[model samples]
Target: MKILTITGYKGGCGKSVTAIHVATYLSALGDVVLVDSDPNRTSLSWANRGQLPFTVVDERKAMKVVQGRDFIVIDTPARPDSSDLKELAEGCDLLILPTLPDIVSLEPMLQTAHDLGEANYRALLTIVPPKPSREGEAMREELRSNGVPVFSTMIRRTAGFQKAALAGFPIRDLTGRDRMGWLDYDSLGSEILEAIGR
Candidate 1:
């Protein structure tokens, strides 16, 4: 099984949202479980209310339950300490660090990447503006210039995300105006699966 941890040193970077959406997409391929490591239990609460297709469990029993699963998408806490980050990285196949296209988010993301020390990780741009601004592209360039591998697919900022979270539905399950949000995550899921050769 591949353990994919969605983490960042800062909060409000779409970590839980990415974890839920990605887990939903990956579920189509194989058995996928979302492990909520955040003390707030945001993803677990959403799962409990939304009745997501896959299972949702707390961190306490995550390792044991993920033994035979195809993917373990972990929603980690915000701003984990260095030791905690190290422990979380252990045995993880991929570390997905989602960041906003701003200096505040990018700075900490870079620091977190440096602390991890050569682990398999990729930085994903989240909350990008919908009007095709250069901000997202610029942020990707900045990260790449700093030696951080970044994903070309970026999660755009949309009310659809908030709607999905509030209604307990995956972005892909939404219809009408909110449905466009699924495309970004779908691209991200495809890239991740391809990168890992799954």
Candidate 2:
């Protein structure tokens, strides 16, 4: 079993969105379970409303459930400094930190990845914008220099995601994709799996 944890230092960085998509896409290859470690239970609520394919557990009860699962995809809270976040991250095979291309978002992501390394956790970047601004490309180059393994595929900004969130559903279940978000996510999932050596 391979445990993949989706985490970030702040909200609106696409933590839950990436977790749900990765879990759904990974399940196509093997059995998978979604674990909600966010206090808000955002992933759980969406799963309940949409009746998604996998199961979601309460934050406090996740560890016990993790011990028994073949694959656990955790949606972690944005607070990277928390002891619980460290514990959850330590238990995983891979840690995924998603952030927008903005410098405000990028700085914390860099710091968190550093902290994860200090705690002996392996992490990678996600949710990078497709049409990056000048500063965004600069941030990517900076991350590369810092030795962070960024995915070649990025989750572009899109209204399809907003519609799916509003409807409490996954993008794969949504319609009218002028651009296919799942393709990006699937490619991302494959990269993450390979990175984890799973």
Candidate 3:
């Protein structure tokens, strides 16, 4: 199985949300399982509250169900200690770091990147505001100029994602405007599949 880990320096950057959606996309290819390593059990709770296409288990229970799955997505606690960072990078096929497009997120995200020192990973910009707000594009350009590996698809800011989280279902499950959020994740999943297949 290809193990993908979603982590970040702080909360509210869409780590768990990204993990769940990525796992859902992978389920299309084969069996997939999401392992919630966060002490908060965000993904696990989400699965418990609503119906998800794939299985979600706590890290403690993961070993039991992970076998034979084609993909394993992990949601890790924010700001893991230094040693844990190295171990996590070494243990995963891809390390996804989700960050908001703001100074509050950059410092820690840059630090995490510097600490990673060439680990196979990509930085995803999430909660990006819509037009008239240039934060998302600006951040993506800034990161690219610095030679950081970043995703071209950004998870735009929308109440749909929040609603999905509350209802414990993927954004696609919701009708109307909420489905727009699902499109963003679908683009991200396409990008991720390309990255991993390389």
Candidate 4:
């Protein structure tokens, strides 16, 4: 089984949202187990309301339940310790860290990546505004120079994501081929799968 863990040290960086969407996408390809390791149960609530086909396991029992699954996606809680995060990372074939393009998001992301050490990892840029502003390209370059492996795909900030979240469905279904403002995550899934050789 290929395990993917969505983890971050800070909140509101699209951690839970990324977890749900990735799981949904993976389920379309094969058996998937979505483990909401976050104590807040953000992903769990969305799965419960949406009635996703994949199973949801509590963070406490995730390791055991993930044993025989073809794929496991771990949605970690915000504010997780480095040691605890490392434990989760050990099981993942790849660690996905989603963060905004701004400093607030990048700092924690960098820290988490360092904490993960040799764990296979990549960063998905999220919450990027559509129109390029003064901080856009520069920030992207900055991330690359910092030795962070960033995906070319980016999730543009949009109201559609919130709407889809409220309706309990994947935004890709709502946006069709247009990307629904999440350009990065749309292709990011494929990049992640390719990285782990899955």
Question: What clash count goes with each model?
Answer: 0, 0, 0, 2
Please report the TM-score between candidate 3 and the true structure: 0.96
Best by TM-score: 3
Indicate the worst ten consecutive residues by lDDT in candidate 4: 177-186
lDDT of 1 by residue, 89-179 (tens): 7758888889999877777878887888887789999999877588999999999999998899999998998888888889888898898
Residue 190 in candidate 1, Cα distance off native in Å: 1.1
Query: Comparing candidate 2 with candidate 4, which one achieves the higher TM-score?
Result: 4
Please, what are the lDDT tens digits per residue for candidate 4 over residues 1-198?
Answer: 888889877788788888887887788788888888687898777766666657887877777777778888988787778898788778679888777788777677678777877778888777777684635455667778888777767767778778667767667656664446545565777887788897
Per-model TM against the reference: 0.94, 0.85, 0.96, 0.87
lDDT per residue, candidate 2, 61-170, as tens digits? 76666665567898887876856667766787877777777767667766766665555343334455556345456666777787766666677667777777667777
Whichever of 1 and 4 has more TM-score, that candidate is: 1
Ranking by TM-score: 3, 1, 4, 2
* Residue pairs with clashing backbones, model 4: 153-184, 154-184
Tell me how far the alpha carbon of residue 65 in candidate 3 is from the true structure, in angstroms, after superposition: 0.9
Clashing pairs in 3: none
